[model samples]
Target: MKNLDYGVIGNCRTAALVSKEGSIDWLCLPDFDSPSVFTRLLDEEKGGSFAFLVSGEYVVTQTYLGNTNILSTRFEAPEGAFTVLDYMPRYRTSEKSHYLPPEVHRYLRVLYGKPKMRILYDPKMNYAGEEAVHTVFPNYIRTSSAVDAEDKIYLYSSVNFDVILSGEEFTLTDHQFFLLSYNQKLVAIDENRVLLDYERTKVYWLNWINRSREYRQYGDMVNRSMLVLKLMSYQHSGAMLAAVTTSLPESIGETRNWDYRFCWLRDASMSIDTLLHMKHQGTAERFIGFIKRILKSREDTFQIMYGIRGERELTEEILSHLAGYENSYPVRIGNAAYNQLQNDSLGYLMDVIYKYYLYFPGTLDEVEEIWEVVRNMVRMVLKSWRSPDQSIWEFRTRELNFVFSKVMSWVALDRASLIAELLHKDNYAELWRKEANGIKEEIHEKGWNEELQCFTQAYENTDHDSSLLLMQFYDFIDARDERYVKTVKAIKENLFHNGLMYRYKAEDDFGKPTSSFTICTFWLIEALFVIGETDQAREIFESMITYSNHVGLYSEDLDFETKRQLGNFPQAYSHLAFINTATLLSEEKKLSRFIRP
Candidate 1:
């Protein structure tokens, strides 16, 4: 079965997806939201790529360098062998600032005898909307988009521009490198600068990993997931992207695709919460800064998502010129779900904020500013908690009083009460606590399906949703409660297919989901473990690890039958869930460190 056999390398400013055979198939220049400079992942024929061609007699292998984001791919043959190291430069320039440029560095080192290879350097600037003109100078090759004159990139290589541009075969006798940058270099690019940047970036990642708290088991996998999460974080604005790519379908050849390059408040807040537990307080604080910057006024409303730089209106656009991954059509950019009223979002944000007040208290001014945000979120929850709206799934066709949304609404009020009590506002705490109890009573009365013997998907229906498994996760219910146990079991029985878990079985706008929503399976695993089914949970967890792509990374979804990844590549939601569930299964029962409600 085909999988997302790709390794991601980034400097937190931008990222690239290099295929297993040493090809850069997908990349967005300058920033995560920018138009693609390379799009081979979407359209194989028209979308351009950069790859090295070797004879069929050679064997190729790919892996990351140690615990860093650097990827190394080796090609071996009887005649010769070589390794290509790929990375993006990221390091601290000062105590308070970082130096991260939008660039991709490929360092080729000859290992044995002279290796003969050909270079295929093709760049489709501006999403390949129009043809590009490639100009080869003595020192570098410049590529510019025909339609958008302002879009351009430069490639400086040591292997002679004419030889590379012409795709001529050559034998490598010495070390070489290629630097692709969004900005033209004012200083000359040379072997010394390339080696220096590579070493510095390597050291920077090593230092980052050293600072994170280590686990006894599955520590390597946790570190890898953390690095992927860090790469998705935008260094400038502190917004965490859901994924690096757009329009990768959940199921191949279907239109269950949407752009995930923007920051969803629910996803970002959950990611920050996970990082905070990993002892990465800097990322959490920066995200808090991002929140404070966006919510400038008390009257400012909350959207489910926003642009990296706080752009509010992300109008959806279809790129008809390109074919999606595996013929999935109508490649899209910008997400309409941002405007959807997802009540679950406030709970995630408030949960993180409450943790901040508890673990990382700041000056009075900072605390007061965050308190204002908490008050605003409480107002929003009070105004909207009674209405039916989109839940965590972001359903497009209809709205319902989803059980998960109601539980999260209760969470928002509960956290608000805790925060108020911590700040010495006893009256506010008492009011919100009463409100939270009222919502809980309503959920138990109407949201539970006595006939089905479990909490249903919504107040009106008896469908099972895997998201309901998070009730204990958000502290909405006790794990040992009979009702909670039955809900978890019922959802697992209905949604578990083959070895993976489906988000739900009910049909929606597109159709009933066919692929496993990866995070849902992790949720089930965590739920089972919490309910004293450790053996079943461990069995499922071990099997699920085998389903990840070649580089031990997961996407948003996976095909049940084929077990191939089938969604946005390297999704943060999937990674965070894996980290959390793996931590629970790997470590002792002292869940207080990562699971504080």
Candidate 2:
């Protein structure tokens, strides 16, 4: 078996991770919220996969087409070279008929010089331990199995393909091609359908790319990140997943793993802000529509997360069958944290609404119903802001007065003031502003530790937190304030590591600390830029982008030594950070003369 360096290809509904050596290591079919069909990234044995590899040592380089999610990987071996193009056909307005098929599709093509390669198609049904029967055909192999009481199988190739049961292989000469597909139901795919899929997929991606408003200096990176953020989005619901695959492990040989494939309310709101910043109003509108649906459902208390279709019942479970990636073990599915009360979520939601009002002007009546929901949430924040709850890290340890949470609580009221003024409502604008100011004063006086010269992680302790870096970005503190400058310096000295950052160090009763979060590192980059450290910010941003996989994808955490992605692959938080920070940098370059100190 060859070690794989995978890049992702997707439509808005589902995605697949294709390796440089030609392997589909991780993919969730039907939709981003669906159960896995090929999950070797979690468990190598029973977890299914489809791969094609060259016979000898080879050099590999990959990149997505400009401003689109289509991935192209080029491999150069001693014998020859070839380019593998990968993508899923996205829905288009003109081709309404195409939408009738499965919401997702994957295509592979040999686009360049002839190179001899070996292709392998072995798909394990079930999570990681169950067995299925394979029925071989002249042009395809169908493996059928049961998952959670539902019968499911995938059609492996429709064009002169061969397969091996469990452990089989085949070698190929240069310039040859093949096709493989997975679905909830098995159906015969003809050559004409396959050819149309290829054309439709390309056209869909290119058209979507054209819709993006142009950005300078970092246009290429920004466009690619935008496409990635789009792919993670669920088209039917407009809810974006946190990541495509779950339980890749935060630290190798450690158990700090959790499923991250669901849609986080907090992440969804931030995604709206990112799309709006990129001037993609249509995407922003779609996300807002999803949020409205959640509001209309109106469960007495909202969940911190939900499935792509807004399904609320997410029970967590563990799979112990297949061997884990790098032997990480105990691969997991479904997120347990869905039930936790992360108080910051409501505030984040309000922030998106407030920003939308500013970015896209609209009448108060158009969104008044949504404001009623926010009104109820504000009352809840007032009742819960003083109490201890799970912090942003979702640490299993006891909750404390997390500084970031307090900042967002202040935001909840601050944005409420904007809504009140816009709608001419006299209910709580004065009270909300007063309460917001009081929270700011309290955070300034109690949340900072003078002895440490840093804004502490929580009100009662002196430990520095990477999250405090958001203070300036949130406008809770002025970028030029001496105290703000001091906090930035303190984080650099205490929480910084190898130009990256850790959230904070707090030993649980068991004396274990969580690994560094990649999102926090990107947060530092954004903070630096806002504080007018433009050159330093740009250097750090460039260095952080280098940590992505061969095809410009990121995970939740990093394996510092091996430089491998070590969490849920292609985390939405990481991509959102890229979108926000890159937009800020691009804006600064345009306004350098006015903002330069």
Q: In order, what is each prediction's RMSD in angstroms?
A: 1.2, 3.8
Q: TM-score, each model? A: 0.98, 0.89
lDDT (0 to 1) per candidate: 0.91, 0.70
Predicted candidate 1 versus true structure: per-residue lDDT over 1-597, tens digit per residue: 567899999988899999999999999999999989889999999899999999758999999998999999999998899999999999999988887999999999999998899999999987867788888877788899888777789999999888888999999899999999999988889999999999999999999988887999889889999999999999898899999999999998899989999999999998998898788988888888889999979999999899998888999999999988888997999999989988889999999999999888799999999999999999999999989988899999789999889999999999999999899999999999999999999999999998999999999888999989989888898888999999999998888999899888989889988889999999999999999999999999999889887778899998899888989988999999999998889884642343433
- The clash tally of candidate 1 reads 0
Q: Please count the clashing residue pairs in each candidate, in the order shown.
A: 0, 0
- lDDT of model 2 at residue 576? 82
Candidate 1 ranges with C-alpha deviation above 4 Å: 590-597
Best by lDDT: 1
lDDT of 2 by residue, 1-597 (tens): 223367788777778887766577776656665666677777666676776566677787777766667677777766566666666765565633334233334344444445655555655555545565666766556666644324445454433444344433443333333444554334456545655766677777777778776777677777777788888887788788888887777777887777777888888878777777666776777676677777663445677898888878888888777567777877777878888767777777777777666666456565776776767777878887777667777766578888888888887888887777776676678878888898889888888888877788888678888878877666677777888888987887887776777777666533554556888888888777777777988998888888777667778876545556777767888888887777778777432111100
> Any idea what lDDT model 1 has?
0.91
Task: Spell out the clash pairs found in candidate 1.
Answer: none
Cα displacement (Å) at residue 87, model 1: 0.5
